[model samples]
Target: MSKAIARRGIMLVLSSPSGAGKTTIASRLLEDPGIELSISHTTRPKRKGEKDGKDYHFVDRETFTRLRDQDAFLEWAVVFDNYYGTTRKPVEEALAAGRDVLFDVDWQGARKLRESAKDDVVAVFILPPSAAALEQRLRTRAEDSDDVVKRRMRGASNEIQHWEEYDYVVVNTDIDQSVASVRAILAAERLRRTRLSGLKGFVQTLLATL
Candidate 1:
């Protein structure tokens, strides 16, 4: 008799300081085959090039609060004075369909995910090599006000403090290397025997052939 193919999915989380190359790594990962980005619902103003449902599902504060009250989000966090949440339904559906999800969020969101769905999660924390380098990157971007830059710098220290909590940590010394490292982690995770949901059925079929 052949066994059924188990359904499984991966929750790949990448977190970092404001300029720690996490976003770059995440962008590259999204291009990989069969990887889906977790579209978070947020109560924050969209920046240039950001879009609703693609970048984030922008919503009013009342809507966000209502969802939270209803226990709808798998994970939610308040960052930079903005509310960001990952809805439970879509992630649940994707996992049941055996598609991996990539999450680009901070430590708070990561922790929340772990608490809510530890079985399917694999978190990776990215760090800047040095505070000076991080500051330089922030300044180069020219995206934030001076006050916001300082706020992020302070937030970096707090974010880095939770490095030990993640499943993996990558010091983003080089963009290519960092991306490669994360890719390797993904490859390794995909190889986990338990995650090979259809292998049992295939092996059983092979035995019948023999």
Candidate 2:
């Protein structure tokens, strides 16, 4: 009879500037049942059509501050005057059960997560093929005003400066190809020896049987 080997989960962090297709790639990756999004806790007000637990765990500033003081968050950051954090308890539980978690964070948030859980984290940075391509992608959406689009383009430049900090970089010229590349990275990271806690025990059992 064959036994299953238990393994620790991966914290797959994907960071990209606006219009870089990071969210689209993450959506594709979530189709796999083995991985789930790491829903974050935020003090930002819920937007229209956003649900409490689905979009984010919306909490009051007082509660967020309390949790931060207690060290209950695996990583926390202040972005545009709003507090965002990942609670340690649920992620730790999921990892122990061999369930992977995906994080869509900015460069600062990614840095914090790495500091908190260095061993479990795999960070990827997504980029556009060129500045012109990024501007075109943002304009194609037709959802943002001209000023907003310009602001986003400027932000993208600043964000892309941190690309070298990531473990992997994918220049997203084709959506399908970018998704495939990210999927391959996830598959390879899942097989890493350090994540497989049960490998040693499985080997011992096999040796005994042999």
Candidate 3:
């Protein structure tokens, strides 16, 4: 029996406006052992129940700036008043070992990753079913003030404009359905011929035997 061909892992990027349920989808995707979530380094203070290096690599602003200046990040963006960035080393190592890395970032960060690793990156944009629905979801969370919710609603239009930049778009009408769709995308991408690094050698050996 032939051995399995080794393939490079994908950099799956999930981007959505606040309250669009992208984070929820990402959390569900992380349940699979084959997929690993990229832990971003952030300047924001860690919230309750969030751990260092798990939820995020909480760092000081100066440290974050130093890393950013060193070009150590695959992508970085400023959100609200804090800086967030995905480090390059861990992601490169994971891909080399055939472990897929999932990214939960904004459209700006997604765009940066696309420019840097176009072939390895598979970006998806999640959209809420309707504007009213999105606002309602935000309000229901009760985490943000009314002023912040209003600001988010205003910025959501700009975020939606970048949906065209992503390779896939899923309207998050239902959580389970959307998660299934993303899983399907990951399964299909894994089988892509370009990603299977050992495929050429395997095929050549078979042809030689014939």
Pick the lDDT winner.
3
Candidate 2 stretches greater than 4 Å from native: 1-3, 45-49
Please list the C-alpha lDDT of all candidates, in the order they appear.
Answer: 0.91, 0.91, 0.94
Put the candidates in lDDT order, highest first. Answer: 3, 1, 2
- Tens digits of per-residue lDDT, candidate 3, 12-31, equal 99999999999999999999
Residues 59-161 of candidate 2 have per-residue lDDT tens digits of 9999999999999999998865789999899999999999999998889889999999999999999999999999999999887789979988988978999
Regions of model 1 farther than 4 Å from truth: 1-7
User: Candidate 3: which stretches are off by over 4 Å?
Assistant: 1-3
User: Which predicted model would earn the best TM-score?
Assistant: 3
TM-score of each: 0.94, 0.91, 0.96
Whole-model lDDT for model 1 versus the true structure?
Answer: 0.91
| Count of backbone clashes, every candidate in sequence | 0, 0, 0
Query: Lowest summed lDDT over 10 consecutive residues: which window, candidate 1?
Result: 1-10
Cα-based lDDT at residue 105, candidate 2: 86
lDDT of 1 by residue, 1-210 (tens): 123656488999999988999988999999898789999999999998898889999999999999999999999999988999999998999888888999999999999999999989999999998999999999998989999899999999999999999999999999999999999999898777778788888888889999
